[model samples]
Target: MKNFNWTNIRLFLIVGVAVFLYSFSGIRNEGRKIKQAEVVFVDNENFITKKDVNKLLKQNFDTVTGIKKVQLDLNKVEKSIDTNPMVDKAEVYATIDGKLTAIVVQKKPVARIFSGSKSYYLDYKGNEMPLSESETARVPLVSGSIDRTDKKRLSELLNYIYDDDFLKKNITGLAVMPWGDIMMDIRGYDFEVVFGKPINIDRKFKNYKAFLQDAIKDTLTENYKTINLKFTQQVVGTKK
Candidate 1:
């Protein structure tokens, strides 16, 4: 009897079994109908819901319910879901055990815009998001002849405000002047902060903060009518 190479033989057997099982599973699942479909959002604070996903799926893949797993085109299904303006990313896949899964991520809105002609949210990526009646996002409100052209600098300002806890809580309104100066309205104070353009934006904010720090000690914030940040390295306050 020839001495057997047990290692080689064992490897071959393992590979052969794996191949056989894969082929068998594929064959067995081919005619089996898709049992379930699950849709999940990547984040807890989401604009889109499972019901919306279901509606989209039904609209795009009407025959998916009774179709065999092998017949489903996951790529096409994903593309359909991704068409929604609210969706930032979408992934669709099917498992051999007769279940299809979809994972979706919704766009994040940083600011809301009330332009003359229309109203929408400017997402972090500067894309337009239709204002939601179901839920309202707590973000800075921008008004005054704004359009998509202002999205970049607008996004930057919103980001700065949101990043700072004090600014996020106190600043409620933002307005753009005709000559391109940006104005912000504080929640409690009646005055508006004139933030001219975005030049030296960080320094302007620093100066504003310094002024506030000093004003709080003497209660001067209430008397100031306007805090102009257009001048170099200063926050010029006008009396009421």
Candidate 2:
């Protein structure tokens, strides 16, 4: 029992010393001037470039490099980067070796909106993201009388469509009418889909899918000008 206690004490002392040395090294390195600044896109989605991030850092700190690691407000730096429309989130930190690093996650655009002369992207979370000149996202194009108030409802419908394989691949564009009716343009089809008022959404989609399968099987797809899903429990097809 005495030998075991001595062994345990020695092990605890060794661990304590190691931790103390590591902490001391970290404290000393915090005073060291930054040798380099690196912007790492965790998602590899470069909607905002590294140069843009460096420029932002410059605005915040006058200059990033040659500044002491201890002097940097990582929270401030992160907030500055996060304010960028392209960045979804940002984490800024200094490495032990005098390197300042910013990890950024770019927003994922699920749809592009064109309201009047202004155009922007709606990210997966339904937040409005200004279009980036650096990158273009291939997503559903939405036009017509859409306003900010309409986006939440529209985003729900868009998310549903995107989650479905057939809808994601086939539906390309959407037009919102002033009366809150939604019209969609489908791929490889002459018919327009009248998706009316974003209500009974899942049921409407199910009804549309059933209609589509039957129409294709019966060679009736080309006979329609508009496939309407506004009515509950049934699909209404207007003849061309």
Best by TM-score: 1
- Cα misplacement distance, residue 34 of candidate 2 (Å): 2.5
- What are the per-residue Cα lDDT tens digits for candidate 1 across 1-240? 999999999999999999999999788888788878899889865577788887877775674577787777778888889988788889998777777889999888778889887888888777889876557889889988564235677788887887789998988988887777888999888888988885676788889988989998998888999999888567899998
lDDT of 2 by residue, 1-240 (tens): 335688889999999999999999888888899989998898856689999999988786778888888899898888999899998899988888878899889998878999888899988889999988888877889998886236678889988887788898899999988888999999999999999998789999999999999999999999999999999878999998
Q: Which stretches of candidate 2 lie over 4 Å from their true place?
A: 1-23, 147-149
Write down the TM-score of every candidate: 0.86, 0.84
Question: Going through the candidates in order, what is the number of backbone clashes in each?
Answer: 0, 0
Note the Cα lDDT for every prediction shown: 0.83, 0.88
In model 2, what are the clashing residue pairs, if there are any?
none
Model 2, poorest ten-residue lDDT window? 144-153
Query: What does candidate 1 score on TM?
Result: 0.86
Stretches of candidate 1 off by over 4 Å are 1-6, 29-32, 147-150
Error of 1 at 3 (Å): 6.3
